[model samples]
Target: MNMEFTPDQLQRYHRQMILRELGAAGQQKISDAKVFIAGAGGLGSPAGYYLAAAGIGTLAIADNDLVELSNLQRQIAHNTERIGMLKSDSAQSTFKALNPEVNIISITQRIIAENVAELIRDFDIVVDCTDNFAVRYLLNDACVLMNKPLVSGAVAGFKGHLTTIIPGQGHCFRCIFEEMPPDAEEPSCRQAGVLGAFAGVIGAMQAMEVLKLVTGAGEPLKNTLLIYDGLKSEFRRVNAPRNKDCPVCGDDPYITIPGC
Candidate 1:
């Protein structure tokens, strides 16, 4: 084992460090990684919590929305007292409390195309916990252009799905969903009514994927879409192969711009 980890850190992560796949070396990789999470709502909550507890070196959470009373249903990072606070700020506070060793950066600004590249430029990995399709596409394109790995998760009603996208190695988000669905076609969580615990399930999985990516512990979900059906209590993995014709990560591409 390396002498870099403090006695407290080694004890705190003793259980994980004992795992055959992730020993002290893997833990060191995790401690040196910088992760960017693009939301602080349901999906972001558990994802951030687990990553913080796992001792991610630096975590940056970005969200422009304010916590509403309804958000408490699944947004575990924020409590009733923080109902009106910015989601990013609330998540930072919660993550900091979970692991004071983690460097948490709270960004309360919207992640528009104009600033997406700059926001993620310094990070080693990006986690897509955003709710909408527009920001998803924005993140997908930006990650592809920047050659960053992205752990994407989404939940709606009793269903949730997750996938890991590595720039050149696998399919990008556009390969699976060609274009953003019309707003009317896709109902927001408000209309569909998400199950709180279901979001936690997928969010925790996202964190696991990040850990795998960081430490090279095991195979990640790259080019695979993991689906969860809470009502039926089933989990499915679907093959999501790369599209050679994909605009973002294809041979003859079109979306060469980082955040367009």
Candidate 2:
């Protein structure tokens, strides 16, 4: 790839370029990559912000939610002034403000059985910032089917887990857990109650994973899961092996549908 950066881009990303791992070439990789972030809430907030500031070429945010007063506690993308606006709309505005040079695509729709594949087909990476297991599973299955990499993270209260899913290369989300929670609920940062700073920390980690995946700077979080306990300021990594009997990606697949 004949990748070159203009004077303006160099000036804008000088700090990022100074990092030995993220030279002009890596920056160009980021500049040419498209990322699909599946939420505009807490995790998605900082993930999208940093990616935009780092100059990801295009960020497609899919969120069929609206900004509410309660989201202000953890979802840094939306503010009091943005109340009543769609979450995607609020996030797109924030992203543009951070770096107008970054292209933003806002899909104010839910990721459902009918359209998840189309949303991620063109993106270089997909970030699972959504709060529920259903959306997480959907994204996992879609990415696995399409052979795309997915950066997955979730925060409930002061604890969170982050993992990278590379289908056929490593364990998928389904490989870890067989089925969704029996009593599934619409993921609400409101009801679950998350520590604000913990959300920022996890979200920022998610952004770093995205950069690493795009720039090829380090070993991406594949075949393992990182867990954080904000209450004690402790962190740990655990092995995540792909199960041969995994319903979605295993030898004998249970769920099969086109364009999941």
Best by TM-score: 2
* TM-scores of all candidate predictions against the true structure: 0.96, 0.97
What local distance difference test score does each model get? 0.91, 0.90
Q: Write the per-residue lDDT of candidate 2 for residues 216-244, one digit (tens) a residue.
A: 99998899999999888999999999999
Q: Tell me how candidate 1 scores on lDDT.
A: 0.91
lDDT of 1 by residue, 225-245 (tens): 999999999999999999888
Clashing pairs counted in every model: 0, 0
Q: Which runs in model 1 stand beyond 4 Å of their true positions?
A: 1-3, 184-187, 258-260
Clash-forming residue pairs, model 1: none
Residue 169 of candidate 1: its Cα lDDT?
90
